[model samples]
Target chain A: MGPPTLHELFNPVLFYVLLTLGAVGVALASPRKGVSPQIIGGLVVGAAFGGVLVLLGIRGNEAGDLPNLYFYVFALIAILSGLRVITHPKPVYAAIYFILTILSSSAMYLLMQAEFMAFALIIIYAGAILITYLFVIMLATQAPSEEKVASLEGYDSTAREPLTATLAGFALLAVLTGMMAHGMSDLQDSRQVIRPSVHSLEAPILGVLPNKVIREFEQAAVFDHGIAEPTVEEVNDGFDANLRTMAFKIEDRERFDHGLETDTRFRSMLPETIHGDTVLVTLPAERGITNAEGVGFTLIAKHPMALEIAGIILLMAMLGAVVLARKQIELGEDEKAAQLRTLGQGFDDDVAHVGGGM
Target chain B: MITSLAHIAEPVTTVAPDIFGDVGVSLYHYLFVSATLFALGVIGFLTRRNMIVMFLCTEMMFQAAGLALIAFSKYHLNHSGEVFVIFVLTIAAAEAALALALVVLLFRRRETLNAEDWALLRG
Candidate 1:
């Protein structure tokens, strides 16, 4: 009725079949001791991935909801690399493949219009986090000396309970995906349902960031006079159609109005700025809202305490790491007594020498 | 003045479409990706005997969670989801620091990175 839901589009039986195939493939691909059929397993997994994606595509087309072709590309890369991350025998190679997974998923984030987070994922996860992983992997694993260089450690070459683990993991996946498909609705009107609250919180951020507003207005060349600084105030009484009372607080509304009156085209572009009782100054549609600005505002305004807690957690982690990793030199009981006697003798000698010199 | 000010109080119903152009990917699609990634992480964690690789699997799980958060953020047209992801990243970074340090310490003592070496002590 309302744009066909994923429940309607996705066939459960076919999905389970593909999922089971994937589980078998993963088990076969997992690192094993001798004559591991990794190539066949990889092919099987690839086949399963292809089948599931193709099924989704066909169903989506039937429902007249064309899937984003790029989603398929990024999703394939991400999942395959993710599989490699777990299946690869060598730790260094596995870490490298995980980087590939991070990169492709970040690309998906870019596709989702979350540009700030996409780049952050690349910089933080791929750049910082994966580098740490590689360092630890290298640090922990011993490279075999010249003669036996090709042989990998026993633990590195084989997986523990690969079949059982794969079975359990796929079962979990089946349940999660099945529930998501069934329980979730394609709420096309959810935007309208949530937008009012989001807008109320988002608009005040412009008030705090007056420079941003001024920059946009300057770029538009709509205002001749230097716009006055906006005064943002929190409204105490919180119940109305719009919960936040002071949605936008432009102190110099008269000048703003005069400028708007002069430029009809610009004014029309910014229809939300003019209302009966509130002088809300929102960014023009052309300028739009940047991802970083929205994320920053939400972090500071709504979840300041959480942000602070995160900082504290990081600091504690740093301290804990230093304490945990530092090599502590322990002395035997006899060694400690001897060392203390030597230290005392040395201090006495130094004092005597100083007193004689004086 | 009152008429213009009244515009400020008007509820904004249309917020996401104009900015993103169209709702291209369905919520279920991203959820599927997230679920698969998470499940793989679980399998990797359970199967891998190498301690570092096990920790790496946990990091993958964190990445999966972050992906889901971003997707939900886009779906709801809310930045709070993205904000939560930043926190998730912070927690992940913290986890990596502590876990790696413990790994290094363990490796120093036993000269091995196999998780099974510590399993008896853990029990």
Candidate 2:
């Protein structure tokens, strides 16, 4: 028999059962004042998570349809670390776990072939944002005095409303995953199944990148048909006109025309040799559109307004941060007295330093 | 060694579903992960009383949303989803800045990171 489909793999009854188990596990695992049943709860959550993944894997194995092993590994890390991020008692430890979660998420992004976004996630989210979080966590945390055991604050040690939160969260998860598992068949029917073209999504972007195209084709044409490579002198004299003067017949007219309508760059530097089907048509360079270039074009060409808005939003955030940080709030009397004492001590130190200098 | 490395680097050119209605790895797998992450984020945000960690949980939600967007983008064979992730990252950064600044300000006033300290301030 053929393998169990999406519905069978994500059996509603089993899914909900496991989801309930997980929700309970999360509630139990959440940090609490006295002896918390965290380890047992973690085991239950892991078992539940593993049960679903293993079920999916078994069905996937039957169909010979599974993601790369790395996908499973990355997903495991991402989910487990995410759990730890919320469940860990210490705020600093939670932040660290959150970093692990971000790293694994970025790895998953890499697996999904979003190379630009994967690195951007690392750089922006992990590198920049997490550092800010660490800074705030450190700044906000009250330092422990020397005599006492370094204990967690009441808020840090215990979750606020674990049962209600886990129930709400996992119920939403159950609904979402349930929809995805069952509703996929409908989505498949509605979606016009376009034959997956071997040509990449970024293939047309090559036409816009003229200089790279020229550099690539120049060698190929010269090697194959002894077409003269445009000289440095000719390029220096008038690069556009010189490039216009040089053209080659692309063997595949249909494919060239396919990209032609979308790409205006093709219209400007028209291919010189039109009608002949002699040489192979390798006009669009073999090296596909890079992740950065593809994302750059999509950002600049398609969503210029959105990009502008993002910049403005960032600027406003900066201004807002500055305003908030610079605002003076009323200090408690004890803190005000402490501040004054520190200022007085600093003034005395300055006077002592000035006397020493004289 | 080089051949093995090349095998690992083999590119997936397309994601269109095959005869059995499978895109090798079905979109459900990614959606499952994304949903799980997002749910965890919600749980974290709701349960954690540390205001900064609560904000961190919100960041986790943003990360989950970005993952889902990228997955859909891949499923559709489009670049716009990835573009949207860029914007998500931008918003996440802005949020971190403003949220952390607020956290610092609140910490200054109350000298405590507990959310319960400000429970009286409905506004």
Candidate 3:
């Protein structure tokens, strides 16, 4: 009846509940203008989901990697900011949010073990495109006339063309449904890929433990005792039970005896043998690849293409932005000069009229 | 205690008849999230009639697509999903530029930013 395990926190139902709560919290906290509750809710949900994943042993490729959580949080923030770009009324504010979103999404990419994509997302989207958007917004700020403002206010009423919006929404939903169905079908097939083989379980553990101790144990136990070698399952089950007991004892040592037989029981549970006696022990390979060099190798060598494509995409995006933003004035020199003179004359006349009226 | 924790930690493996019963952060979750986002984008696009906001909705769609890709990638344990996401980000940036340029051009032509006022482009 009580909560069973920490992993239950990751249960989809629990995750959904947390998501709903976070969404409600965000909606309540948001200011009364601009972005809808949905966008804010998405941001809050994404951040919380990523945070919970980290806390619940889903961090990176392995469990217990907490720093990666920051990357997900950043991505969520970036996404929120990006959403704000369109939601905000002010162009400057939109640009700011867009920039923040790009930066955060990039951080998310890094967190997902895709370092190259993250940097590319930031450099191209945030550095180039958003700046260009800002420039265009700034340059195009000819104050709207009173009539134009009045029209904009009225536009919202007429804008709700239900037929078109609904049709598009339904179409999107259909496509999403189809895609989701396909994805789930594929996932169902993938369960067969890893069959929880005996070797797969033991190899990782055996790879990590000291070879010298293993050899010494093997010589003493197998050669001397003439006992059949225990299977990987036996070792793992024994180790699991022993570890649980040790953990429980650590929490209440006075209640548990601190003796060699107690330690021997733990040792006998271990799969590895020593001195013809069933020694209870814990294997080491559970902590895979802790060296800095190994970490670097895993990052760079394993996923070079992801990194390269991210870089190329960012570069191309930047170049494209520069080209798009390069202004082309179509006016000839004489026409421009004549127009400026006429504009100047109009300005002077307006200034004189205002001065005389004042 | 460990056994109890294990039971709590593990999701109910047995499937129920409900639509959501089998959905354990699967492709459907990605699609559901995407659809909601796409709907929001559409709503924003239609209701606001502001070119900037419309473009923002388009970005929202792009984000949804990225999310979908990532979810699929996670299911497959492949990097291609992420690669597709990178492409989406690039396309989004390019689209933003073109959209803003068009918005600026429209503003210059009609001397108004309201979409309703810019019917000159209509066939």
Candidate 4:
């Protein structure tokens, strides 16, 4: 779309070609016997090559943005760790590498200003999920007999259909990276005048966001705790146009009732500091609220149903785990006789009755 | 767009100095990172035979998808993406619990962690 300059250094053809080479290297280097030094060497070189390609594609400047080396560093770590996760024969090592990937991606999220989700990822994925995985790996890989020492399974040492799998994976990557290279040009071209994506400062802060959970049968947290307006006006061009048609509560005294056209105008939601005919909403995230609070408020305010469903899901999972892990009951002879007697003529009780009492 | 060597020389650009680089972080950078991570996940999923490792790979893909969602949120300047990530985290936890239980049961039955060994239903 915008001259496709990524092709010059990171052109799809070259990138894919190199990626294919790297993918083949990974597949061929699959753990057989043990991870060969040559395979590790090949993998390191391949990853280093990929990193250099990304570094080459880095563009110099936009406006009001400062790109630092850490983005590149975290990105590389995520990539390399991701690669290590799949290649490592040991499941435990894979899980450890997975932790590195999560941590680095969280760093990437923090860089993008998503502070809440970043830490949440570390807590949930690295803290909870990874621990479960490590436990499972330790449990599942143990030897059944006491005499036989626990050892790696055959599948752990040998990869299944690695060549085809890597090829398929690289093909998908080629298409995606190609899209990122080609499809994102117009956005780059339009970079001369960078517009603020969200007008959080210009928008009115909701009257005071009451920090409390909504009681049952309430209009949700936004009404109970009074979450600020969703900044719909700033993000959506059509919202302001529609607001003009809707009846707004200019004078607070009238009996107010309408659909979204309720008497409460955007101005009513703002603090006393500013006055305006137009309505705008400020994000709690921008208003000095803690990052976690901002995310929780948004969750409670917007996706309360989802939060409830998540809890229900956890409950269901608990039940499912119990059902799956319960020890199987072996029926005793007397119980089997009782069960067989209840089955009537269909099942012979002779087996339970010692040679049919012949 | 004229070709300039200075872009390579200047490590930081003003796209956003505090958050991104000289030409601050764009949607494309995050997209690229996510895509690569996803491909790695997919490759692992396809090639790895250990069930636990395979599950870990799935988590990697989930992370990639979450990264993409957050990047789009930053582009749009919205909170929706982060909200979706919370749900993603929730589902992932449930999935881990169930999957781990299933893996343990299978291993108990076969005394092996290899996925292919449990394929009695192969048609």
The global C-alpha lDDT for each of the candidates, from Candidate 1 onward, is 0.70, 0.70, 0.46, 0.62
For model 2, how does the per-residue alpha-carbon lDDT over A1-358 read when each residue is reduced to its tens digit?
3323456665667877888888888988999889999988888888788777766776667666676568787887888888989999888999999999999989988877788899999998889999989988987786544432243265678887899999899989988887677666655544435323312122332323456444343333321232233469967876432121323445445554555535675554445444464332233333335566566666665677899999999999999999888753433245755677777763222112222232
DockQ of each: 0.34, 0.30, 0.15, 0.27
Error of 2 at A355 (Å): 54
User: lDDT for model 2, on a 0 to 1 scale?
Assistant: 0.70
Q: Give the candidate number with the greatest TM-score.
A: 1
lDDT of 3 by residue, A1-358 (tens): 1221223224445544554443343333222334435455556645654554443434122222233336445644653554354345555675587567556655554444445555666777667766777777666554567566555444433334533553555455445544554455444545336222211222112123355433333333221111123458867766342121101112222222233233553343344333223333432332333222222332244445665775776587566545544432322144654677787663222112222232
**Lowest-lDDT window of 10 residues in candidate 3 chain A?**
A242-251
The clash count of every prediction, one per candidate, is 13, 0, 9, 29
Q: Which number leads on DockQ?
A: 1
What's the C-alpha lDDT at position A324 in model 1?
83
- Candidate 4 overall Cα lDDT vs. reference? 0.62
Clashing pairs in 3: A4-B5, A78-A101, A266-A280, A267-A279, A267-A280, A267-A281, A268-A279, A268-A280, A269-A280
The interface root mean square deviation of candidate 3 comes to 13.5
The candidate 1 chain A region of ten consecutive residues with least summed lDDT is A221-230
Taking all chains together, the TM-score of candidate 1 against the true structure is: 0.77
Please compute and give the TM-score of the first chain of candidate 1 against the native first chain.
0.72
Model 1 off-target regions past 4 Å?
A3-7, A143-152, A186-196, A199-275, A278-283, A328-358, B1-25
